[model samples]
Target chain A: MTIAAMQGIVKRYGNELALDYVDLSIHEGEIIGLLGPNGAGKTTLIHTLLGMIPFDKGSIQLFGRTEKVFSHENKQKMGLVTQELTVFEDLTAKENLEFFAGVYGLKGEERKKRVEEALAFVGLSSNAGKTPAKFSGGMKRRLNIACALTHHPKFLIMDEPTVGIDPQSRNHILETVEKLREQGTTILYTTHYMEEVQTIASRVVIVDQGQIITEGTVNELIANIQHEEKINIDVSTPGDVPVERLKGLEGVKNVHVDGSTVQIISTVGSGNLDRVLSLVKETSGVVGIQAEKPDLEDVFLTLTGKQLRDGEEE
Target chain B: MTIFTFALKRIFKDKTNLIFLTLFPVAAIFLPEPEYWPLLPYGYHYFGVLILFVGIRLTGLLVEDRQKGVVKRLAAAPVTHFQYLFQNLLAFSVIVIAQCIFMIAGGVIYDHELHEPLLLLILFIVFSFTAIALSLAWNSLYRNKETSFLVFMCVIIIMALLGGIMMPIEMLPDVLEQLAVIFPTYWLAEGMEWVVMGEDTADFLLINGVLLLYTLLFLIIGSIRRMG
Candidate 1:
């Protein structure tokens, strides 16, 4: 059964549209990556779907029932780690979990067992008594997740769970998320980090200007977009060479020379790198040359025609 | 019972809050300086009133869950809004009722006849429920808990003093007394005094009526804020 279906969702704050006729659906046991630059209606979509905020016009169905039927039982099936560090800082890690367990009406020995499992799941069993004030930034994030996970939700929604965290913690969290998905928890992960989406998400939804611009599986999205392969030449310095000289190479779709970096967009990934490297010797300052694959950023740029989204609040 | 479990857990874990919610009110009853000292068998009435009456503004602390995002998160769980508010009321009411009972015991230990235990309990409920309304009403406007808490405390402190939390209600000028009477805490304190001292049963009924009406008005207003 489909887990969630939100159709033609329209939400407004005063005159500014927070969500503009947005349509999205989540299937059972699938990880959907909500991708957008800031203010791209990602938070609005999550909040609306969770029934935290009411929309101006739209219909929401969860578990094949209307939003009203999404009762405590339905709500129990989902866990959320919000975009901010909101866990109580003064309480110990165990205390935090107990409260959440209580939130789900889990009590007595049943709650104690669940709390222990959740603490261990987040790798925080050793620090169960530690308060957020004494913990590092990563620990706080994990505690927040543990609070959400004590209920063993079927679906999880995390907003930018890895932003500003150290590489080690980020990798650990990403791995934990993968493990959750493996255990059959459908996931909706939102972030501006392309590598994060590439690593964990099966499907990518790109939102822009309060609407879903396009969405598909990661590979399908990559296949649909035609990005000019950008060949980067690390040179000692750029020269006054004719820009057309590089353009003359086979498969070279466009050429732009900026300072010590030589950027050439090639139409075909094959033979272009080789031809570019062979001609690199002609430039005296060419130090290193590399050709890279197109990523979500490229697909987004190609689809929206804007390098950065205008996510400023009205 | 649901709110009780949740609130009980919260109160048990919180150490800093012990002073603000409990010990401080008890300490207010006795003082090293006579100037700041709380009222006796007489002011115990205001004490009961202040204990629960401040609940009007203090309820802001609980409703603040939404603005702080805690309420929204908590709401998503197996709990209802009524359960949430009920738990919030439980957390403070336990403290207020305990303090009242403790004071009554103290009065008995001193061999001063405890005038009306049931009436005092009723007065304390009126006090606490009114505070609940004030808190719920203000929560919709303030997004941050600390700011809302500070504002609520300051406003309530001023109102409590003017309403006779510190002084005898009869000492005030007739005009000021009437003005202060409008504040639920004043009527609550006056009603409690009547309960504990065995006088003004008529005034007690008026205060109880005002307290019920005030609590209802706030509950209605707070429900509106919660809806938004």
Candidate 2:
């Protein structure tokens, strides 16, 4: 069953196009990882889906209902864990959950039970009385998720939930998301981390330049790429090797050089590694050599001609 | 539990806000009045000044919530925009009424006699509504909490000075006195004066009607901004 569908989404800021005719469909009980670089319209798409910002043209359907304006009932069926810490610093963990639950009209024993359950799910029950002001970065992130979980929405939209936290907390959040998936909750997770998508996403959607460039399961995306093998070689004397000579080797599709290291991409069954090594040995001494199957990062680099974290430093 | 109750509970949980809201008015009752303010009742006049303080504090609370993303978080929940704003307004109204009650108690503790206690109570209630509406309207005009708070303080101080909360309106220069009527604080203070002097029902109703009009106008603008 389709949980939420966005068809032909086009969003613009003045004259700049933020989203250009984008389409996304989320299925029931599936974790769809929305992978993109900075300013790739990932946040814009999430905001549009949540009805935080209006799009120039699009139709959104959630829980099998399409509406011109999202009703409060529709909003209640969806939960958003924003990237920023949205929990109140003055309010304790339990109080924050209670406040959000009350906003959803949960009352009496139901509110208390849900708040307690959410706290326990996030592993913050011991610090339920503590305010977020004194919490570490990881604890605050967990509490942020717990606040969203108090209402128990059908579709959970997490925008980089593990952006800046300790390894333990990140793993805990990932496990919690997996548990939610087991409980039959549809999720749309957005992040720039390819490893995260590789680990938890049932399907991967790569968005770039305001549109989805490609999308599939991790293996499917990797298999769909032209190059099947990535080879890395470190040389003691890179200046001795000729770039044209390496490219001329049989089945060597692309070559990239960075100081003393050389990266070679090739198609499977190419038998290019032996020829390339023989050619390199004649000119320069090889320090190290590695050959492996392509991952999502290699696939993204091949498609976009840039690293996923490029321009993120700015 | 409705959003109103939730928000009110949150506000009460903040010990600083509770102390400021309750204690400020109580402290104002102890300030010695200047003899130059003979045209207005000093006790109610001081209470009127506290009303502006409540307005500033209430506006600050709403603006801080917006800055902290609490409003956006609530918007994503089962609550509608109208429900959110209405609850916030209702909560602030309750706070204003509590402040008024504290001011009344302060007046009694000081052995001050009000000529028309019932009329004074009615005027305070209307004034509370006006403050809530005005605060909401003002809050929608600025996005930054600090900027909104600075503006609120400036407006309240200027209004209190011109509206006779600081001194009698009759003591102002003719031009300043004429310009004072443009402020809602003037109407509030002028209405309270009428209640203190046992003015006719027609006069009392007219003043209350003007304050109500300000409340309605502000509520309309605030609601429009909120919807936008």
**Leading candidate by TM-score:** 2
Q: Model 2, range B165-222, lDDT digits (tens) per residue?
A: 7767888999999999988888887886686564488988988999999999998887
Q: Evaluate residue B109 in candidate 2 and report its C-alpha lDDT on the 0 to 100 scale.
A: 68
| DockQ scores of all models, one per candidate | 0.46, 0.60
* Local distance difference test values of all predictions, in order: 0.74, 0.82
Worst 10 residues of 1 chain A by lDDT: A305-314
Interface RMSD of each: 2.5, 1.7
Chain A structural similarity (TM-score) per candidate? 0.83, 0.82
lDDT of 2 at B24: 68
Candidate 1 lDDT by residue in tens digits, A1-314 = 68898899999989999899999999987889998888888988898888877799989988788846558888888788887775766568998888888787688899899999999988999999888889888888888888899888988899888877898889889988988998899999998887899898888999887899999988788878855577778776477444677789888888777777778888754466766765665653578777777678778878877653344332
- State the lDDT of candidate 1 residue by residue for B1-228, as single tens digits: 545655655555566455555565565444232333233354464454455434543454565456556766765566677777767766766765676666555555555444676676677667766776766776666767668777777777767767877677677888888889678778766675576465657778888888889878877877765533
Q: Give the C-alpha lDDT of model 2.
A: 0.82
True interface contacts retained by model 2: 0.65
Provide TM-scores for the models. 0.85, 0.87
